[model samples]
Target: MSAILEVENLRVAYPSRQGPVEVVRGVSFALGRERLGIVGESGSGKSQTGRAILGLTAAGGRVTADRLHFDGIDLRGASPRIWRQLRGRRMSMVMQDPKFSLNPVMTIGRQIVEAGRRGGVSRRDAKARALEMLEAVQIRDPGRVFDAYPHELSGGMGQRAMIAMMLVGRPDLLIADEPTSALDVTVQLEVLGILDDLVRDRGMGLVFISHDLRLVSTFCDRVLVMYAGRVVEEIAAADLDRATHPYTRGLLNCLPRIDAEARPLPTLERDADWAR
Candidate 1:
């Protein structure tokens, strides 16, 4: 598959009282029409990398890259207008939680329709597309959900609605930041299955960012292990157990196995050099 997104030496910094602090330092990766998982501990800059790609960083944050391209478009130099045209149209994001991401006042269907409209679809057509997307995400009753507000839905339903809204535009690339982290194991698997099917059927690229090493290994094609704002290792998901990097091994070892003997869980030992 051809590359859908590319980044080289990407950096994101913020001005601090102590001077400039780099949250994402020299991160680089390429994504294709396949599921790519970014796994790391919290504050490791995994989310920042995704946000920088979408140009959604905070006002005080500065993002710079030697090369940042999306479908051959130079994202590093993209104007605000260009970004507006691209974001939610050619590319979209499914954030961690729907309660915070969704508009509490708007009906779920209306939000999905608005997203479709942003991609240049008419209101009438967008509404139809919204219902279709809701159903595509496996919502049993699309009509009922269409009229429901974000606050009226359960966690899983709200997440499915959020997915519907994001995918309504039929974006080429989807950045899902720990999208299933807030759900139960059963719901998490269900959501993962939905995402898997959509990516396969739509031929869209996915950037699945999460700290769940086991989940990512099974659900994604490749995995990028990050530490201290940098990619410490990149390995095929199938070969995750064979990862050589200490950070990756540490993460994998932290996962409790069902067959393991009863013993205290191993604690991850961090090396300061990994952050350098």
Candidate 2:
């Protein structure tokens, strides 16, 4: 498949008392209609890179890049008007927590309908399409789910509903940030399965960002390991065990194994140079 998104020499920084605190430094990557995983610890700037691509950085943060393109359109410093045009229709983001992402007072059905309406669907058509998406995400009672409020649903249900809403726009690219981190293990796997199915069925490009190395390897096609705002390693998901970077190796060593003998959990050793 051709490249759907591309980033080159991308940098994001925030102003501080002393000077600029850079989060992402010269990050570069290209994504096709396949799954790509970004794995890193807290404060590694993995999520910042994703937001920068979507033109959704924090107020004080600044993003600079030589090239940021989506389907041959340059996105570097693109106007807000263009972003609004593409965001919900051609591209969408699935945030980690639905409780915060979804409107508290809006009906689930109404929210999904609003999402569909961004693509110019009529209200009736939007509602019907929303119901269809709820079913696509494996919600058994689409009508009930549509009528309920975000607060009335469980965590898993809400997340699935959010997924359904995100897909209602039929976006070509979906950026999922720690999408299943708050769910139980069983629910997490189920949600991941739903994402995989969507990617396969719709040919949508996926950027799965999370801290769990094992989960990313299992759920994604390729993995990019981040350390101190920089991509330290890139490896195939199936070959993540053989990662050459010290940081990647440390992350692998730290994961608990089902068959391993009981022992002290390993910790990642950090060096000052890793921040550079």
Candidate 3:
């Protein structure tokens, strides 16, 4: 597969009372039509990197990169008109929570149809695609969900709806941020499976950002471990257990195993030098 997105020496900064605080520093990666996992703790800039790719950073924030390309388009130089054309059409994002992302007044079907319509589909065709996507995400009753409001759905249902909305546009790249964090273990796996299948069937590139190292290791093809706003390690998911970075090893050691004897879990030791 060819590269769909390429980012190099990316940095994001926000002005603070003290000064400009940098959240993401010198991050670089290339993504193809495959699942790429970004694992990091809270405040590690994982989400910021995803947002920067879609030009969704805060109003006062600044994003600078030596190279930021998405499917041969220069994201850094893209105009608002260009961004509007590309955002929902070629690239879409599934945010962390549907409760916050979805409009309360909009029906589930309306929101999904709107997503498709933004990509230039006719309203009638958009509605049909919305129903198809709802079923595609494993929702049992697509009609019931189509008419329901956001608050009427359960967490898992809401998430499935969110996925349906994002995929309704048939985007080539999907950035899913903590997509399964709020679900139960069973629901999480189900959602992940849905995403995996969709990516495989559509041949879309996925950037899966999450704090759960174990989940990412099992679900993703490759892993990028972040600490203090920078990528500290990059390794294949299958070789996650053999990670050489101290931060990656620390995170792996922190996960409690089902077969392990009863013992206290090790605490993650922080090193100031790792941030430099």
Candidate 4:
């Protein structure tokens, strides 16, 4: 399959009194129209890598790449105009926290409808699509939730609304950051089903960033294990157990097992060289 997103020697650094602090250190990968999961602990630069792809890096951060291309568009020097045209229409990101992704004052309906409109849907169609998305995310009383503001809903409810908003538009590439973290198992399965259908049927490329190792291993076609802003291992989802990297083996060993005798789970031993 052709690549939908490409990154080579991608680096993200922020200016600081101490000097430039590199958050993403020379990460590289390619994504096709399939699920690609990035798994790591907090502060592992998974979120920052996704943000850089969407041109949403924080202020004063510097992003440089030998090549960062998305469907033939070079993202290294892309202007605001280019981003405005591409984001939502061709690509969209579902942020981990709805509070950060959604407009607190705007009703969910308006936000989702706006996303649909940005994808070139008519106002009437946009409204319909927005409501359909709300229902798809397993929100009961879609109408009521649609009219509610971000702060009015619970964490999980608001997250579902945000997912609804992001999926309202037909994006070729989607970067989902811990999207199902706030959702229940049932709802998580439902949402994953939707994502699966999008990839299988609509041929949408997905970059699924999460801390859930089991979920990624099952859902993603391939997996990238990151540590301290760099990829420690890249392995097929099915072959995760065969991963040779010490970091990957350590992480797998740490997982709680049901069949095993009750005992304290082994913690990953840190290696300074893994971050270098």
- Highest lDDT scorer: 4
* lDDT by candidate, in order shown: 0.90, 0.88, 0.91, 0.92
- In terms of lDDT, the poorest run of 10 residues in model 1 is 181-190
Comparing candidate 3 with candidate 4, which one achieves the higher lDDT? 4
- TM-score per model over all chains: 0.94, 0.94, 0.95, 0.98
Top candidate by TM-score: 4
TM-score, candidate 2, is 0.94
The C-alpha stretches of model 3 lying farther than 4 A from their native spots are none
| lDDT per residue as tens, model 3, 1-276 | 789999999999999999999999999999999999999889999999999999999899999999999989999989999999998888999999888989999999999998899855799999999999898777889999999999999987898899889988888899999888767777677778877886799888999999888888889999999888899999999899999999999888888788886366588889999999
Poorest 10 consecutive residues by lDDT, candidate 4: 259-268
Clashes (N, CA, C under 3 Å) per candidate: 0, 0, 0, 0
> 1-276, model 1: which lDDT tens digit per residue?
789999999999999999999999999889988999999999999889999999999899999999999999999889989999998899999988898999999999888888899956789999998998888767789999999999899988898889888888888899999888767787677778877876899888999999888889999999998898999999999999999998888888888788986367687899999999
Minimal lDDT window, size 10, model 3: 256-265
